[model samples]
Target: MRRLVLTSLLLAIVVIGLGAYTRLTHAGLGCPDWPTCYGLIDVPETSIQIAAAEQAFPERHVEPAKAWNEMIHRYFAGSLGLLIAVIAFVSIKLRFSKSSKVRYPIFLPLCILGIVTFQAALGMWTVTLKLMPIVVMGHLLGGFTTLCLLFLLYLRINARRINTQGEKLAESQLKKYSSYALIGITILTAQIALGGWTSSNYAAMSCVELPICQGDWLSDLSFEQSFDLIPPNQESYEFGHLAHNERVTIHVSHRFGAIITGAFLAWLAITIFLKAKTPSIKNTATILLSLLVIQISLGVSNIWFSLPLKVAVAHNLVAAGLMLSLIALTYKLRQNSEESLYE
Candidate 1:
């Protein structure tokens, strides 16, 4: 079960990276179909295969490179699903074993499996829906959430193993900061969602300048259109009508959210360093602070350089890492608090 959990964690990380790459390269709709690329197991490259693909997807031209990118993402996602399924089964088996050290309920692994299945559906809709902003953002969030849950499960399992051997921490060291850390997680999640929305709507290029948007602290913007999730009746999978002002609304809102999230995290890190009793807690805090800095730098570079592909993709990846760090810090605090109950 440990091996399975570790495998899933690594694969989940790859999926996140590949997902970001696909989106950055505009390959979300590269296949124009789900579970297959141009109606084949792989992208069509030969003349014969290209002709067949063109015939089948007449309206969608065959781009071999983009199609391969999407298919690779799908394949990795499918492999991750299999790993999670194994985890669910093994965990359920361990639940009945009196000798097992695992403390988490069987339901957690099962829940992750269910989430992976739902994520698969979202992946399909991402293509069939023509990269609709809402669905795309949801897909991105779902991927991150899956990774977060799996990582937490890994930590819980290992911590439980250590505790079973009587090595658990003895005091409620981070009790005072627990709630604040959780609140920081919530705000960071919202900021990530805003980032997803901005990316999906192609709003990142709206300003190209940092502190101010379009050379103005405030500009004419439309929140309604910017946040619109309603799609037209037409089957065409294209971006909904969005004016420059609406895009600006999304871009600026994401910027504001970043400011709030960054400030809160900075305060949380300082407090942790000064008050945390354990080296593990202090190290997690330090890592979180470092990731926060890198994430901010990526965000700025993305804009300053007019959304270069590599920087943009790194921004998305670092955002995931930031979430993982917060999840770890908060989970550790909870574990310590629980352990203090007996002493």
Candidate 2:
């Protein structure tokens, strides 16, 4: 079960990276259909197949490269969903089995299964709705949530093995920083959502300049349209429907969100590092700090390098990494707190 969970977790990361790649490459609508590419199981490769695909979905021509990208993401995401189901089944079986001594986490696995199910729905919506910003953002957040939950499940499953070597922190110390860690997670989540919104709306490149947006962005701010969940009616939201000003508003807002999130997480990491008595706790904090820095650097590189495909994908992946590191820190703190309670 542990190995299964770990595999699912790694696959979740791959799904996210592939999703980012698909989005960055303007392949969100590559299939023009859910769970299939132009009514086919795979991309239409043959000339005849391509002709048939184009004939069926005349509005969406067959771009083999883009279609393959979307389909590949779907394939991995589907596999991860199946793996989660197996994890849930194994968890329930273990819970009911009298022969098993280990306390498997039944609820967490079940919850993960539920989330993955919804994530599948979101994935469909992402394509069917023509990359609607809200749906896309929700899908991105869903992926992050699934990743964090899987990491949490892994920590829970290995709690005994993990805590065996590390010196436990005092309950008082744990209490002091747990809330801060939780806040850090919350802030990072919001920031990630903002990033998704920016990307989904094609606003990532709106602000080319560093430190701020272009040409008196303050005067050109259009908050209402930028954050509007439901924009004016359109046949499709592909390539984004927002004006330059609106996109700039979203991009600038994401930039501000990054600054706030980075500052808060940095403070939390440093505080935890200094206050932690256990090497394990301190090491977790150190890793969190390192991820924070890497994430920030990636953010800047996205702007500096004109949002290169590799950098953009790395940005998304590192955000996941940063979130996971924070989860690790929080798990260590909470585990120590519980141990201290019993001690």
Task: State each candidate's clash count.
Answer: 0, 0
- Model 2 score (lDDT): 0.88
Q: Please give the TM-score that candidate 1 achieves against the real structure.
A: 0.94
* Clash-forming residue pairs, model 2: none
Instruction: Return the TM-score for each candidate structure.
Output: 0.94, 0.96
lDDT scores in order: 0.84, 0.88
Q: Model 2: per-residue lDDT, tens digit, 36-150? A: 8999989999999999999999998789999999999999999999999999999999988999877777788889999999999999998888888999999999999999999
Best by TM-score: 2
Please estimate how well model 1 matches the true structure, expressed as its whole-model Cα lDDT: 0.84
